[model samples]
Target: MIHLLRNLALVSIVLIAAGCDRIGAPVRVDDAWANATPAGATVAAVYMKITTKDADTLLSATTTVADHIEMHTNSEQNGMMQMRPLSNVPLEAGEPFTFAPGGAHFMLVELRQPLTAGLRFPMTLQFQHAPAQTVQVQVVELGSR
Candidate 1:
């Protein structure tokens, strides 16, 4: 009876230790910002820098202030600027993915309200490998960033 109890405790400990890795995968988000929107505007853009130790993908982002969020990239085509939507942002180990203006960014479509300068809003980010992280996105003037 004692032998069986000891084996059960060891099995439980092993299972818990294995789960800790999945629960705590390290992916870091930094320098997150959004440009403040003018009154009556329903769209805005967000920028950020992300780094990860393992290969990971940024699956989606959500905020209460926006009707929906989507990832987009800007490029020049035949002397005209074009915006394209991205399905996901994939990263390699130790490589930082940057989202910036006139480049890759998040589009906040149909905003609930204008994002005012000096305001910080909570945005939750979902990842392919690491756990979902909620980050506070700071709002700045349009030309300030």
Candidate 2:
């Protein structure tokens, strides 16, 4: 009976793993782009649309282009615009989230090198329930829409 139970458990695990889309697909990401940083610039921002298959929390992000990445949301404080770092952001299943300019975005803090147009890099998104997804971000020239 123990051997039979063990086989059943293994099959269940395989079924569950197969239910989730492979890495980078369970959390669907679209329109990932970043702005080209000017010479000597130390920071940059990336914008993207994300939709998770399951209700989850976006816990963190990592990338090779920056010293560190922070999840940020813009707010007004004392009549001044300010951006604050967020510890985590919640996501509703099948609901799309946008990280755009003048709103919530991933701040690439302390960039190792200035981002240039046509450059591409990977940013991995860590979630509470979904497997981490690595998305490619395309850099666009600054001052362009």
In order, the Cα lDDT scores of the candidates are 0.91, 0.91
lDDT of 2 at 134: 92
Itemize residue pairs with steric clashes in candidate 1. Answer: none
Which parts of model 1 are misplaced by more than 4 Å?
1-25
Residue pairs of candidate 2 with colliding backbone atoms: none
TM-score of 2: 0.82
* lDDT tens readout by residue for model 1, 1-145: 9999999999999998888666555788899999889889999999999988778899999999999999999999999999999999998987889999889999998999889999999989999988998989999988885
Model 2 residue 112 lDDT score: 89
Compute each candidate's TM-score over C-alphas: 0.82, 0.82
lDDT of 1 at 10: 100
Model 2, 23-140: lDDT tens digits are: 3356789999999998999889899999987789999999999999999999998999899999999999889999999999999989988899999999999998989989999999
The 10-residue segment of model 2 with minimum total lDDT is 18-27
